[model samples]
Target: MALTGAGMSTASGIPDYRGPTGSQRKGSPMRYEEFLHDPEGRRRYWARSYVGWWQIATARPNAAHAAVADLQRSGAVGAVVTQNVDGLHQAAGSERVLELHGTLARVVCLGCGAVVPRAQLDRRLRAANPGFAEAAEGVADQLRVNPDGDVDLPEDLVASFVVVLCPVCEVGTLKPDVVYFGEPVPKDRVERAYDLLELAPALLVLGSSLTVMSGYRFVRAAVRRGQPVAVVTDGATRADADGVLKVAAPVQELLPQLVSRLASEPADALSASR
Candidate 1:
């Protein structure tokens, strides 16, 4: 099994929140509590998200993503799981990928439990706030977008920006369908991830620092189960310790070569090594 994180998409022009050494590189991300309890916070979030959506919407899957798909097709890797919400794995033609966090390509209505495509919400937001996207680009400092598709905007601009409600409910708050900071992953999703881990003979981690418990727990679980674990990433990871075979390198360059080498190896030898 192979697990990926934000670094998996960095080659596609998206920035990771933390560097290789597990240090935060971006501003503090909005928390689940803030989004739920703070009205002004919601306003700021949507305004920034409206501007950042373009980057995510236009982002194409990079080489690493395609290589992972190839590895899966060649039977070198089994299950694929990702902490990224970008949906790049599926875009790169990897099938049955499990997204640890929900995807940003969707939105859910808080009031009526309605789910809608993000593109549909984007259209509604555009109609509600005319010329806002263009104006935000002019005002924002370099328009740097965060992992969750949020950009930092001035307070005045946030106040002036209009937030559109969920169209289906007509009065509910609209939130991107993703797991935010401080929010728990859905129980069913967690269970499915464990199932995948239980079935795999070994674990391969890519591009994740595993700074947070969300992704780190899997590494610990693999260790507890006596499963051979390997980590290939550019920076320091939480799993860079005793049992894991750590290789510090850029995944975009290494994964393709790794796939090729693995494909040529005898299946019995590979299984025996694990």
Candidate 2:
């Protein structure tokens, strides 16, 4: 089962990071280069992110997360692969899972490739930027999660935003564990998900538009193998054309139902396992 983009998490109270219909930095999600190379742009991102981080930190998993976990426990789903970094599935007790785009709970040092949990950075940010000392006054519909997994501020506050630097490394910059634009998803990761597909006869996609072919490529593979594809989302998705079961509704509502309907047998659960 694939938990997709923004539409998947709306019930969790997290805003969609992309689209005019969604929230956060507000255009088609910002380009990775802008966050890395541009100063003012970077500041805008960090400021919004700083405030946005609290939203993600305090956010809880909704029914979608619970249902998926239930599906796993019942041996109906082998693995729960996701593009979201919110860590909701694990929190809900899903054992075998894949973070396809990476996770926001962690930050990676560009220089040495060491990973650090974002909670540590949050503490540092509170000390470094006193505005966050109290509590993040939630921003309306911010991506909350960014390329660096560092901080996200609202658009209104972007102009006056300041960024917190990496405390552990002298010169290394921090980046979100998620795949950024222009970055390629590890081939092994994609192939590993395909491994799970080999065990199942279908790929059920929820909440994603499948615009990022990195995640959608598996859908294509599922089709090539004659695996059934089902999708649930309120918005138009890039993979709508490929769906055998398309439900124009929120995934939070449909996932639990779909999981309930799945026969209780996990013979083909998770990334193509032998």
Candidate 3:
């Protein structure tokens, strides 16, 4: 089963990454390359990121996460593939998880690939943007974290702050280990996730609007395999027409109840044969 996107985490109150309905404030957000190559872009990135990191760091797993974890224990779910970088699935104790989007728990220096705890970066960013701790108090209400921890804030503020250079490589750039938009998912991870998907009789997709092709690829694969695929989300999904079932609802409001119902019942009821 794959529970993906900002829709899944909305229950935990984390915002999405793209528009008014999502997290970006204005203009195109910076990608890994822009943040690395352009001085002005890096400055814009760090200024907004200085505050966005707080929200991403503080977000906790919600009931949907807990229920999903419980499903694994009950043997109702063979594996979980997620598009979240929040690490909520682990926090809720799901063991067999594949993070399609990568996690935010660690930061890697792009120049050296030396890994460091993200907490270290947060402290440094807070130190550089002294008012950050104060300013960040309610700012999450307005913005969501970009893949590299930056937020899309107003033009002036984003352009004003300076991005501190990577300590390890003064001339080199920094990037999160996350797979960004326009970047392909690593081949090894994709193969492993597909292997897991092959074990399950079907794939259940939840809380994804499926706006991006990255997440939708699995749904397509599942359907092509004739695996019963279902989608549950607030809005129309790119997979809705092809999905065997679709539910328009919030993941938080519906997932716990659904997982509990499905977990308690015999798998045979869902047409699964032992």
Candidate 4:
């Protein structure tokens, strides 16, 4: 099985939370508690997200994502678990991807529990805040799109942005379906990932630093089970000392080559041929 993270989508124009050396590159992200309790925080979030969504929506899957799909088609990789909220894995033709953090493509109502496509919410936001996009464009150079599809905006801009209520409930707040930094992933999803790890012969980690426990736990579980673990990323990972075969390289450059080699011969035969 292959596990991926934000680094997998960085080549697609989405920035990763951490730098190549595992240091945080952006400012503090929104916390779950803050978003849920602070009305002003929600407004700020929606305003920033509204300006940043276009970059994520227009991003195309990179070579790394396509290589993963090719590996899956050849039966070289089974179960893909990704920590990225962007739907690039699916966009690249990967099937049945297990999104550890939900997706930015969807929005959910906190009150009515109604889920809707993000595109629908985007239209509503545009309608409610006319000329907002043009204003955001004025600071486009200063705006940096974060991994969670939000940008840092001036306070005046954020205050002026209007947040729309859920159409289904008429009063509930709308939130991106993705799990925030301070929130716990749903239990069912965690359990399912554990099961996938237990059944897999080995674990291939791509693009993740294993910095967060949410993705690191799986690496630890695989190690405990005596599963051979291999990591392909660009920098320092928490699991570097866990007896993993760590390859510090860019996934977008390496994955395609790996897939090409694997497709030409069986695993055992390839070593013999080499």
> Top model by TM-score, which number?
4
Question: Compared with the true structure, what per-residue lDDT tens digits does model 4 show for residues 215-244?
Answer: 999999999989989999998899999999
Per-candidate TM equals 0.94, 0.81, 0.85, 0.95
Return the lDDT, model 1, position 109: 89
Alpha carbon lDDT of each predicted model? 0.87, 0.68, 0.71, 0.90
lDDT of 1 by residue, 1-274 (tens): 8989998988887888785422422457879999999999999999989888889988999989999999888776888989999999999999879999999999998899999999998898899899888888787568776789887788888898888988886999988999999999999998899999999998999898888888889999999999988998888888877579998988999998987887788989766655
Worst 10 residues of 4 by lDDT: 19-28
Writing each residue's lDDT as its tens digit, candidate 2 over 192-231 gives 8888878776687877777878778888888888888887
Measured over all alpha carbons after superposition, the RMSD of each candidate to the real structure, in angstroms, is 1.9, 4.6, 3.1, 2.2
* Residue pairs in candidate 3 whose N, alpha carbon or C atoms collide under 3 angstroms: none
- Tens digit of per-residue lDDT, candidate 3, span 1-274: 6656767676665666541256433456566567556777767666776776767777789988887787787777768888888888888999988988787777667777677766777777667766754654454455655544556666655654555556676655656667766677889888888888888787878777777877788888888999888787787778767846988887778878877688667768844532
| Backbone clashes in model 1 | 0
Question: Against the hidden true structure, what lDDT does model 4 obtain?
Answer: 0.90
